[model samples]
Target: MLNTSRRLWNQFFRKARKVNNEPLNKVSLIVLIVVDIFILINVVMGLDDISRWYISPSQAEPCYSQWQNYRTKTTTDKDFEIIKNSFFGIDNPLSQEQIYQQVEERHLGKVSQTCFQYAKYQEQINIPPNQQIIQNIEQKQIQVSQFEQSNSNIRAQYDSTLLEKIAGQSREKSINVVGAEKAKQELDQNNQRISTLKQEITNLKNQLVTKPESMNFLGFLQEDSNFNQVEVNYQQASFWYPSIQLGFQSLFLVPLILVALSIHNFAQRREYGLIALISWHLLVIFFLPLILKIFEFLQVGVLFRFTFDILSTLLGGLLFLISYVYILLIPIVGFGIIQLCQKVILNTKAQAVRRIQDSRCIQCAKKIRTHDTYCPHCGYYQYIECPNCHNLTYKYLSHCHQCGAFQESSHNHA
Candidate 1:
């Protein structure tokens, strides 16, 4: 039953995919970019809407391979280093030694001479706003329905008694009906208030959830040491903005998305194809972090903290705009380009669909990849094969373009 259900589901999805011709539509891409940009701006402005979209704030597992990852913390590191240097310059030798010991112990073999950050551990929210609200709404609605149902059941028994007391008298029946109607009206009014209150409560809860202090950024630190580190605790009995959390997560997500997109676009295309994709990603992820850190580093040199802030803000805008154009828009346009090449230029779909297993480049059998169209190394064409008879087939094949085979096969004379 499970397999059968899965097969049906897959069939439906495959058909849907074919009809769409791409994973995401232009409208979807535009919406994602618009929403992402809006959220990015909100995050920059300290609006606190970071994890609103599907992307959630993870523990920000830094990919050790990317230098950009380190740059992100560069500013914070500089702050610590400056504080450290100042301590040493003031002849506070013990404090500097303690700080170094803490760093060496905590970052041992992973981060050398890096200041420990006591950032709050945050996770991105996955529940849709509607889902979150609707869940509460649904519970209340169910309660309302249940109350009415139970009330009706009780009223049915009361009506029996009332009818008995009326004793077939028209006047008594009329009086009883009027009284019941009045009672029901009062009950309904109260119920409505309760329902309204439930809705209001849900909204308030959501509001609180989205507030800046809802998620603390202090718990993300390597908890081995606590004393003498930056005590960036969540205050107000708790604090830190969801917008920042989500927005930062979104910033992380965009590059991840772009990387995934490029991988899907050019994964099988070539060995060197990702050089461009990764390079762009590094600029956003690693370079942006690096530059911001540099500003932090030179904050002492230039004696201008605001300079770093301005540079970081400008960098954020530049990143968003570039992401919209290159990371976001490029994929939508690139999908069109792929389709155009397959239809107008080559009269065939991308060669990437042909890769079967082991990362073999479908187009030229050069490099391994997942979802690209052409062989980047040799520029070879990739083709789908008829599953039934093992003959090469076109993407839109109703029958095997090579041997007139359908996806399904029937017994035939060999």
Candidate 2:
């Protein structure tokens, strides 16, 4: 097995290093290596592009900003508290349906308002007015921020004074429930005042919206059937972008690798396992593309869409079945392929042809004289004594040339 492997390796190198009878120059080999390197780099770049698309934080920035602007008009502190609790609190956390409902009630209204505002502004909004409106919004935000800072400081001082009074009562061994109740009332009043301030801030922010921009185009698209179809197409592309990129990358990369390997190993097909080589190449070239296309088909949600509709409504479930089927079928198919290579595909005909070219080295396919017992090019033993005529004959050939008699040896059959 080791000797066979070594011989195969030698054959591979011999083909890689030469074309016809001439050795490939160092420059040509270097060029081939560089091309392979470039292919590797291209694959890496494709991966980067896919990752960038998937994790694009900026894609929703405009939507988020518009959502925030809308929230100033619609959302209150109570709504904010509910959202924060749903996210972090351990007790009575929101169910998926409840969370979605809350989001729809609060945010969907804003989304609608935003779209309506955009439609209204589209007719009248100009560059100068838009700039002035944006400036006004920024100034209102600054004022709200200053007020919030001042409110925070006042709240902190009131809380500290209440804590100190409670500690003092504890030290005196006389629990002042009246004093404690008054302190609680003051805290409540302070909270009410802060809430009033926040409401006033929201009103100021709402006044600054002189013009509105179209940000939720995706959401706005759902209102019309034509626009809804466009949304579906966009969603499909967005969903499949990564998988399609991967498939495309593999589509090019795998072929390049196959070509490189073909140049290095199958240059002299007749001299090697020609049948096995050809069959393997066909399998690789066929199956790899098919697999990639299957992945692309899956990623685009086409099965969820209408192409698979005629076949079955539950295409997604069918795909899961197909995935398991592939898992089982692949090994069986692989075993069959291995058997084909070992038994039927890699037959002795190729070796017989090589033996017919008996004047050449069996290992390297370099020309040799009939009298030479071993190949000068590859050091492969090429000649042996014929038992019938006691004369030198080709070792790999079936019939002895000296007497035209059959060579009864296991090596000859092989």
Clash totals for all candidate models: 26, 0
Estimate the TM-score for candidate 1. 0.19
Q: lDDT of each model, Cα atoms only?
A: 0.41, 0.48
Work out the TM-score per prediction: 0.19, 0.44
Q: What's the C-alpha lDDT at position 210 in model 2? A: 18
What RMSD does each model have against the real structure? Answer: 24.7, 13.1
User: Following a full C-alpha superposition, what root-mean-square deviation does model 2 have from the true structure?
Assistant: 13.1
Q: Tell me the deviation in Å of residue 209 in model 1.
A: 38
Model 1, range 1-414, lDDT digits (tens) per residue? 354346345533432232212345676546545654664454344322333322211212121112223234655333222212221222333543355444445431222222322211111221244235435655776776776775665566556545655675554555344344555665676577667866775564555344343333222222324321222222210122333333455475556545644553453245443343333333244323323433333333232334444555778755445334335543565577656744674331233234444455533335635455555654544456577777655443346656787744311100
User: In angstroms, how far off is 276's CA in candidate 2?
Assistant: 22
- Top-scoring candidate (lDDT): 2
- Give stretches of model 2 more than 4 Å off: 1-128, 131-135, 138-157, 166-222, 235-359, 370-373, 381-414
Q: Model 2 residue 316 lDDT?
A: 58
Give the runs in model 1 whose Cα sits over 4 Å from its true position: 1-240, 252-390, 394-399, 403-414
